[model samples]
Target: MTEPAPLNGFGPLISFILSISALRDWAKLLIIGSFFETCRRLLATVWSSTIDSFFLTASFEDHDDSYKWMMIWLSKQPSWKNVRNVNISTGERYSGNVPDSEGESDTSGMPKVCYLPALSGSYTLWYKYRWMRITRVSEPIPGWGPNHRDSLNISIFTRNHDILNTILQDAKKAYQDAQGSSITVYISDSANCWRELATRRKRPLDSIILDPGIRELVVEDAQDFLASKKWYAERGIPFRRGYLLYGAPGSGKTSLIHSIAGELELDVYIISLSRSGLDDTGLSELISDLPERCIALMEDIDAALHNSLSREDTPTPPNQTAEFIPSSPRTPTHTTSKVSLSGLLNALDGIGAQEGRILFATTNKYSSLDPALCRPGRMDLHVEFKLASRYQADELFKRFYLPSSPKTPADDDQEPKSNPAQSHLNGSICDGGSTDLIDLGVPDDVADSPPSSPSACSEKSERAALTYTGTRHRGHAPKLSSDQLSALAAQFASAIPEREVSMAALQGYLMSQKSRPSEAAREVSAWLQKELATKKAQNETKS
Candidate 1:
């Protein structure tokens, strides 16, 4: 049937044949080109996903100078939390002609991988698997097990202990927990947990529980203070609270604060004005970004005062030059190296919204504090954490000696539950041996009832004592009166030398004493003796 079609021009038939061959070759080439392009795309996607998943990130936009400044400044901070064995992949390389820039690969920034047990009683760190990869988990890991050995062995084998097995396990767990049903777990080389746990080395707060007498007095004040915080919260304002604790050097101010944080189930954001080199701007930014629910503390406000603002009020006749200028040198006058108090003030409770910010400022010199600082708008409640009165001692004992546990309501009293005197005490002391109520001397009669009855001890003077005990009461902490707490705080404050002692030091000391109560007690007694001796000598000199 096709034989009839051979009757065409020779030139036309030849052109048609050539056209057919050209079309066939073009089709083959297109198919080959498409296959290569698909493979390249797939490889790129795989590489990017792997990098993104395996590494933690700290993004800094290349176009912004602030990003560069942040990186440089962060690098200079010796105490900054390290990023750990992380491999950073900056986007800049992916910009312009390059891809995968190595600028962010500062291994030094990564945190050192080390063993950190879960604070919760759980020994297992929980992790989940996704898409054949361990994704996210938050459960505690075995404190000591195969994983621990693997971590140590890895350190030995790779000589790069940076990628610790325990750390990987931890990171893997966290990743899996966060990923949910995702087939991928994005493990971070470094855990932000280090930054949080660093303060674990701090002094324990329980050691400064008040003596029975002081607890009675201070417990109520603490309650009122808490009530005030709740009052603000009830109005729908952010449930932020600020405390200004000022008193003698050995007062239990700092200890009281730590106890409050622990009892309230809150995180503590401690800002040592003397240490963290925070300019007004830096302090403000840090404050602004603080977690919505936590405590922000600034210890020793008097020492951190701005010299300029202080001088402004000292009998200076409006910009008058000093009568006696410095004779040391015709030195070029420069702005005095002073922190801007106004800047700090604005950063705190400025005209702007500071609704949810909880600030606690402590100092031994209340007189040195500016009146404006303690004015109604700023530190509205000025409570002095003072020496332990008789009432404070008992409360302090209860807080330190008691073992916190979930309690059943007590039915010991037939008096109306509404009556402050009839409030039944719940919760039991820890199995840890109990110290004699007054073997060391000091009144034991602090309070007879539970701490929930704020009204029973609700005098303004008793507010601090009652409120302080309220937090400890539910947590298996000892139940000391305000008087006892005050004395305990005083005892603790005096333990450190006259020189500046950090909250960390205090916390560490307390933790040490927890398992060794006798040692802690002896240390406390010795410190108190020294403080009394010093006070007596000062009085004689004044006379």
Candidate 2:
């Protein structure tokens, strides 16, 4: 009975609405719209499937090396010259093989400029007659502030992956060609991820004035280690080597390490042990993440682990100075490193350590290091670097003042006219001069004459016109013959007093007298006295 009463109310309402012409028209329009919308969606799905079957897409993350290769390759593309939209970047990320759009020939001392595809913009390019679409997008990282992850999406019209492989190979080759003359240096970021720091010009191994056999020993050992990977795999040994360069501050330890890296053609990854937020886990991760072949450098290793070193538990000898033995164990500050000695030791030669990495550790206080850290499996070779010796000083002086360019045959043929004063100072057999003591007093500033003031100018202008009496910028060294240079180098070495001053100190003193090799040799004795006196004062104050 209830169903029957409702049937009539529904039927009358439906009939009344159907009687309206506008309602019928509205119903027809609604059905037509629904049909068209359904058809549009179906077509879109079909088109997407067709694209998926025919296109090969690849994505390169900014953190990966492929991203760098692709960016470098894209910058060298001929299409960029005609493209109206681009991103002009001053950062080193896109620095390889990019032409300067500003038309400046001499870009030295200026920030490198690179043109990249604008962010969020799609670019169509042709590679080997195949069509490719490139899209660069930035997505926000979960917790990193103000930092976003970048990815390069490339879709080519061919389904064959061989084309993609070809593109990658060409891109890598371009990148390598651009980086042929330099070594890339990398450092860890706050997230403990490696980031490219800079590309340093390869430092010639000869430029590092280390003791004889030191440079060759380190370089040859590293080279051998790199070539011995298969040998290590057969013996079930980890194919890794470590070098410990411990010596006085300002010695050539760091310089030698850099030169060895360049000579080996390996990238340098600097692990700042004192970096904030670094713990044992982070250190282990960093070491494990190192590429198969790389130079991992840790400078001033003792300073970072002063509190956790093995010597902390041992009693200091009474004769040892505070420099060698800390008065008190340094507690790790909030901003300092939290890496323990055990963590560092494990990270160096742990099971997860990279197989072919070369670890270089430098320290001024070798006695303070843990014996476990310097063990054979960890630090395979230990090299002691002392202060500048006579040989190092002589070599350093010659290298510093020597002309960079090669000399002509005629210039080489001409013999140098020996100077009696220099010969006497060098103690050469060609000079029979008296062995009287040379004056060691500070030389007078005879070359510096104050500019005369203009009588018509104001006092401010006159003061401004006065010569700047402060430290003057150094100029090129005076050209001298080989014999003269040899004699001057001998004289400079003689005044160095044998291992009393560091190579860096000697280099600094020579830098002050860059254009005056004779003055550098003549005034070295006076400079040494002041330097020794200043050291004594510092020691007394420390004591």
Give lDDT: candidate 1, residue 425: 25
TM-score of each: 0.40, 0.79
Q: State the lDDT of candidate 1 residue by residue for 164-223, as single tens digits.
A: 444444534543332222221011111111023222222344455543344334445445
TM for candidate 2 is 0.79
Instruction: Itemize residue pairs with steric clashes in candidate 2.
Output: none
lDDT of 2 by residue, 232-340 (tens): 9999998999999887788888888888888888899999887878899999999999999899998877777577765565543465444432232333434367888
Model 2: per-residue Cα lDDT at residue 417: 52
Cα error, residue 244 of model 2, in Å, equals: 1.3
Winner by lDDT = 2
Candidate 2 local lDDT, residue 39: 99
Off by over 4 Å in 2: 1-46, 101-108, 311-335, 406-474
